[model samples]
Target: MAEVSLQNLEKVYPNGFQAIYDLNLDIANGEFLVLVGPSGCGKSTALRMVAGLETITSGTLTIAGEPMNDVEPKDRNVAMVFQNYALYPHLDVARNIGFALRLSGMPKAEIETKVGEAARILELESLLHNKPAQLSGGQRQRVAMGRAIVRDPAVFLMDEPLSNLDAKLRVQMRAEIARLHRRLAATTLYVTHDQVEAMTMGDRVAVIRDGVLQQTDEPSALYDSPDNVFVAGFIGAPAMNLRRGHLRSVDGDWTIQLGHNRLPLADSVLTERPALAGYDGAELVVGIRPEAMEDASLSDNNAPRIVVDAELTEALGSDMLVHFYLDAAAVDTGDPDVLDDLEDAALMIARVDPRSPVRSGSRIELTVDTKRFHFFDPKTNLAIRS
Candidate 1:
């Protein structure tokens, strides 16, 4: 295992199009770091650059402690598993896994030992004799991974390796890959557009947009404390509910006015994010996660309640998601990939206990966890915090 570092990395195409800009990243030894973003965000380009598959127009890239800018892909000691699996269709699993070693002229006995070890680790021993066409999608993907593992590379690079599988298979493979990484403890850089996959599998996640890095941190930190509106909105599943609200500070008390409703801001919120005071008497964006809002009927007495007309309801076993319209403007969050049902600009969703009996066309009360509310500067689209 080896640490990888990218300092001020930049990539520009032959046609003068800049694909990446001043990217700096570090992956610790034996760490699994995931790069995630929408399509054309330069995540793939970044990975290729690290693998020596793409040239670095500017900046420095180091693998372990050696400068690798001029090194060839084969000498980088990095193995890449592509989205298409890239297995040899005519070759059996055993041959496919040991192909690299054979090409390097390793002894046949050594290749077999290495391939057998990888097959056992990936639970593909039963399918070793099967050809690429004979194996399942998951088995083929495991073979692709086995090919990389057989090399025993210092760093592993995977670009959307699970994208070809169905949702259920993808879920199952995700667990397998995570387990494999733990067993090998190899440094890995995985690329994906799915936030859920990034959240569940990564030791730390890096969010990129338009060829520039947005934020990188542990998944929980990215959710609990997003650096910007783009990261906050892009990293969550249901996504945080963002709306423009007018900030008001009246007689030492703070409140946000959204249309006809005036919700008090908890004093602790201001104490933690002292920058919130700067937005007094101005418009700022307010972000509330769906899980942070619940049925008022089931909430404690001190929770702040808001009355809204329920537009629709989606029951998902453990809880119900009640969609309602707020009297405020919706934020775009600057990511073109996010498409929602905010046609009229006031879509809000709340995750509530299913027993609360809230239904469409009925007026329902939702209690917000005010202390956990997020505030952002409208001008900069950045979170307001100390």
Candidate 2:
């Protein structure tokens, strides 16, 4: 295992197209760090730069405390597992796993031993004689991993390795890979556009947008405390509900006016975010996670409530997602993936108990978890943090 460092790494194309800005990140030895963003966010470009597949226009690349800027990819001692499961169709699983050892001119018995170990680790021992065409998608993916394992690389670079599988298979492969990482304890840099995948697998996740780094933290931290409106809206499932609101002081208490309703802020909210004091009587962005609101009748929370007519309701077994229209303007997240939802600020979603009698066109009251509310500046879209 090795520590990977990228200091002010940059990538610029010949046509003057810059794909990555000054990205500074350090991956500790044996840590799993995931790079995540929407398509075309330059995440793949950044990963390619580290693998020496693309040139770094500036900055430094180091692995295990050694400069790797001018090192050849073959000499970098890093193994990559691609999304396509790049295995030779004609070769059996064992041969494909041992191919790298053969290339290095290792003894035949040693190559067989290494291949055997990799197969056992990947649970591909029974399929050693099978070709890629004969194996299932998940099995083929394991074979690809086995090939990487046999080499015992200092670092592993996986680029959406599970993306091509079916949804069920993807979920299974996700667990498999996570288990593999824990067992090997190899330093891994994984790139994916799937937020759930990143959250579930990465020890730390780095979110990027438009060639610039946005935030890097543990998955829960990124979700609970985002740095800006983009991250506030992008990190959560169903995304966060960001709407324009007026924050003002009413009788020494703070309240946010969202169109027709005013939700009082809890005292803890201000105590945690002292910076919000400066936004009193100002228009700012308010972010509410879907789970932050619940059916008032089913909730014991003493938080403020907002009444709205349910536009749609999705029964998702464990909980019901109630979609309603808030008479406020929705803030754009600056993410192309969610442009449709942000086009109108009126759309708001609340995750409520499945027993709640919320249906299309039905009136419902949602209890807002005011203390958990996220406030951001309207001008800069940055969170109001102390």
Candidate 3:
């Protein structure tokens, strides 16, 4: 029901450790915005500042068109759901959900009605009498959400609320939370380290790194057209295959010298990124998504082809992942999660048809979709797009 804005937001401790720097963002009313980044990337710190839990070193925080930099956490009208359920073990679900209402000195009857409504919405009416210790992890999380819902806060702040659950439970809870958001239409700012969760949940996602904002865009835009090397490597499932390549313009045609192979660049590739023409005969970074490369045997299009020795193949029902090494140096995009040793630094994965008979140590041909290839400046690590 309210919009949140952070302009020039900054958080610096007395010890001179700056966790966030000159951050700026605008969350529209009834919009779900996710702040996603690696661990220790200051995402949680930014959220705490907006909730009035952390003092702003220098910046402006606004909610509902009113300044909130000096407002107390309780006065900000924001309900935060932490990773831990943080429910009282002795109190049953009903009392826990209505605790805030009771503290506000609301009538006992009114508290009961509000608690009942939240319980119905969260599908916890049957377990109203059960204590926190008796509920499952998912149930306990729902109790936390119900508690926040009864307050009818102006903004909902959730910090990795699904991290404690199992993978299956996490998936289930993701849908549940998204459904709840749709029904309530409350302004929400969700913070998480998981890229998949951010892509699936948020209307728009903000990627942060080293306490600086990277790119904010829809899931598809982030996946298809990353603004920089870091964003390109961080957003995908099997992170993008980025390697050093030399661009060459022979007569009127263009080609990329990728290690031992020479792949023809399509005309549309240059049409889409006219800036690539400037990098002729120069070294640049090349990025290819797993799906952009397919088994040459299965495809009929006359796309550019490359031969490689398949180091491994993983059969994943619908598609097979072929891991191979291109005879090129891999570009490090500063993602701590990518642990590529020297021997495996140039490893590339291709999502191909599962029916293909590609095995380890076998030579296979792959058709690369030249039009879908991404190019980045080697020095700046930025995408070469017009």
Which portions of model 2 miss their true places by more than 4 Å? 341-346
Off by over 4 Å in 1: 339-345
**Whole-model lDDT per candidate:** 0.92, 0.91, 0.93
Clash count (model 1, backbone only):
0
Error of 2 at 58 (Å): 0.3
Candidate 1 whole-model C-alpha lDDT, 0 to 1: 0.92
lDDT (Cα, tens digit) per residue for candidate 2, span 1-386: 79999999999999999999999989999999999999999988888888989999999999999999999998898998999878889999999888888999999999999999999989999999998899999999999999889889999999999999999999999999999999999999999999999999999999999999999999999999999998887787888999999999878899999998988889888899888888888999999999999999998978899889998999998989998988888888898888854434457889999999888889999899987788899999999977
User: 1 or 3: which has the higher lDDT?
Assistant: 3
Worst 10 residues of 1 by lDDT: 337-346
lDDT of 3 at 288: 94
TM-score of 2: 0.97
lDDT accuracy of residue 302 in candidate 3: 96
- Name the best candidate (by lDDT): 3
Residue-pair clashes per candidate: 0, 1, 0
C-alpha TM-scores of all predictions? 0.98, 0.97, 0.98
